[model samples]
Target: MVKLLFLLVAISFVLLFSLTDFSGESPKHGESMMSVHLPDFRLIPTTGASGPESFVFDISGDGPYTGLSDGRIVKWLANDSRWIDFAVTTSTREGCEGPHEHQRTEHVCGRPLGLAFDKSTGDLYIADAYMGLLKVGPEGGLATRELDEPLRFTNSLDIDPRTGVVYFTDSSSVYQRRNYIGAMMSGDKTGRLMKYDPNTKQVTTLLSNLAFANGVVLSQNGDYILVVETATCRILRYWLNDTSSTTTPESRGNYEFFAERLPGFPDNIKRSPRGGYWVGLNTKHSKLTKFAMSNAWLGRAALGLPVDWMKVHSYWVKYKGNGMAVRLSEGSGVISEVFEGKNGNKWMSISEVEEKDATLWVGSVNTPFAGMYKI
Candidate 1:
């Protein structure tokens, strides 16, 4: 009986040690699997027949803020708070055909992608995929194109207040926004990150041949720039001070992969005034989805089928591939916390503005509820 008891004890010790080792060193190859219970959040109920695509607080103005949706931009006042169309997009509507027919509003044809307010000039810098970069000033506004060449598919935009230099991403050189799915399915790395100097009127390519470069953000100190390579599931860093990095004309600076092996496809990223940057995850990466995406032939064949059939197939794939978010803190390689957004559907781009206290006014491209929360 003593010998039998000794053997059982020994077996238990070995199992315990093995379990501890595995749990300690387990790598998060796909989803973080670490679930987070966020604070109770609700949609700040938007009315008046508008589907706001993006929201930003006007720093220059007081009380009310601005939201860009569909074909119109609306002003939302906090006091006597009501949303009204401040500026309706009534620009040229010629090339707005086919899939982008919705963009051709009776007022505006081009869709606004990214927006930044120029500190020194008080002008709003807009990056429209079809219209390139534009400057819209106050007084119910007029827009003037800053760059002559229209972008292939311009995305996120940010301007450095100190240097007056603007940075933006052209998602794909070969594939436009209408065919965005085609570009992603093909895993085409034709995306480019660019810099435009307002002073010199010179545009330079920072990084090229990126796999769907989506978001661009300057570091807090303006030392390094972070650009997201969406399909590759990584963020690349470009050093502004390192001139001896590379001689290639397409080189922006000495770039290194900042963060990699994200759980899902990264859409947009924004720097928080408090600290850490928030990344918006569109869809979960699943093995089945990866299988479909792995082979070009399979992806093409699937896409060639009827739209409903393709969607039903994708629906099952998405069930496996889902929720993820990462917080990158102060240029450090370490990601602080990972948050899962929604249970079923993915949460696309996240646009945040500062409100009272340190609360973040959050908005999503696809989320049904848009509200504020403390991280």
Candidate 2:
């Protein structure tokens, strides 16, 4: 009887250990403890729209053009201190008036996530989550679709200033913008990094099988392009010279690992005028989220549970108000400095950080207003 009872207790322990998802130890927040001073941020409210996911400036440097939730790309008029609608990705503008329309009708109205410019021709390139890659001339209105192939979730992009070639990310081939959270929770690995050439009007897939590829930026010398994989918390550098090859785990020799195990899930990366790159940490990494993601059974079980319940148990809910951003050295990919929000008024869900004239222009996907901080 004693032996039987001991066997039963051991089986129970094994079952509990297998079924329960205990939180993993949290990683260090930033790369180093050397503190960097961050100035207080001031908000620049968008007139009627929200969620300026990315930004780019024209050759004249007249504006920081940003894409909003209401399916319009607006430019900040520093002269008038107001946002003016510069372009629209979709022609269907009737039902896309309100800000909340993106939640329900983003596919029909088009949600433009990334914005870039062909400095040589004054053509603005946009990555619309629903409409694929597009471009509008200097006289902006209804932007014309450039890429014919379908994309699941086009997120962010950057253009090579010299060649006018564009590089961008398709966040997930399985999930659209509305189901982005589902893709993240399920650990989808179908993201892609692609390039578009203006001269030939061709689209080429550079890399595939990525874990939520989010951002792309060309090196100053145009030798390599840096791409961010958000779910894996790493940055990948693809060689522009090796255009004929496709990158994968097996073909790892073709590309280089730029950065790994970042402090947070990185979103958009922009070239800083002062040199190096500014990376936006949408949110800090949570130990609980990591534990849940580490286990395949726990991740699958999460799909059956209520989304609100799962969110409450996740790290994002627990650390709702905090935000972080980092600056990395260009060639070494070293974390040179870290910027963080103090107190409960955290920057929260930073989508992009555009650096200009020693000021950081911060945008958020969840917030209604964009912010500017003087460095």
Candidate 3:
């Protein structure tokens, strides 16, 4: 009886430790700010929507535009204390305009995941899961689809203001937005990073055979691009030399690992206000989660289990802090971190962390409100 009790205690520790961030020594207090300093933040509800997937600010910096789960782009009017609808991804609205999940009406009503803006033109670009790339002018109403080809799982995007070029990612060819869990678990590698040229109205594939390409962003000066590979828990960098977007022998060589062996599964990455980049971790690294993700056969077999795959998958991946956020330097070194254990209920499944004016705008993929944390 005594040995059994001891064994149970050991198991509990393993479960807890796996839910923490990637393996690394904590940075010095001067080099980085630890999350212990982060307290409860102010909440901004989504009104009738949920899942503020990603956030962006326009050229004038007057708005923090975000895409919603129910297929609408909303802008937060701080002074008015309200969220107003600015755009929608799909013109067909038979079952849209209400709260819903992606598994049910994403294909019909459309689901916008990534949002970006062309600072010069004041045009908002959206990466919709079902409808591909979309755009709305400064006025903002019903966003129009702007892609010649279809992108099944348009995850995230970033724009180059200098050239007005749009760079985005398609999570997987086999799985659309509705079944992203299967894509991540089965280790699908058909994901891609591509760019769209507004001048020519053509899309070019930059890199292929990726393990779940999630968040994306350009350098502070638009010199290179950084992409998050979720399944592998690393960031990949592609240097830009010219306007060439197609894949070539030399171009492929330019793609290299910017950061690797991340402790948590990185979801979205945005440029920090001070310097470096802020990467949001959707889930901490757990033993069960790592084992299942590493073994393709095991992951596929688990899908056949009698239980609900989504729920089962969620059980395998646990969050220790309720949420984890990290800021990386220009050289991909860990600078500071935040663990939302104190108020994990306020946010989880973090998808975007936008820093502005000494505050971190925290958005989650499964939460209905955004949390504002002071830096």
C-alpha TM-score for every candidate: 0.74, 0.85, 0.86
lDDT of 2 by residue, 1-375 (tens): 755655554454335434543221233565543222434667889878778888888889888989888888999998899999999998998888774536677788889998888888999999999999999999899999887888999998888888888899999999888778777767899999998887898899999999999988888888888899998778988887777335656347568788887877788998988778888877766554455456655554455544443333334433453456778889878887776665455665777788998877888887788888777
lDDT of model 3 at residue 194? 95
TM-score (C-alpha, index-matched) for candidate 1 = 0.74
Alpha carbon lDDT of each predicted model: 0.60, 0.78, 0.77
Candidate number achieving the greatest lDDT relative to the actual structure: 2
Q: Which consecutive 10 residues in model 2 have the weakest lDDT in total?
A: 18-27
RMSD of each: 12.0, 6.3, 5.9
Question: Which has the better TM-score: candidate 1, or candidate 3?
Answer: 3
Residue 300, candidate 3: Cα error in Å is 1.7
| Clash number for each model | 5, 0, 1
Which residue pairs in candidate 2 collide? none
In candidate 3, stretches whose alpha carbon ends up further than 4 angstroms from where it belongs are 1-31, 36-39, 99-102, 242-252, 311-321, 343-346
**Candidate 3 lDDT tens digits, 1-375:** 755655554454356445534333344566544453334567888887788878888878866888887888899887898888898887887777665554478788888889998888899999998889999999998888887696778989999888999999998988887778778767789999999999999899998999999899999888789999998888988888644334654335767677777767889999987888999888666565566556676565544444455554444443332456678888754555554433234244677789898878888877778878775
lDDT of 2 at 170: 98
lDDT of 2: 0.78
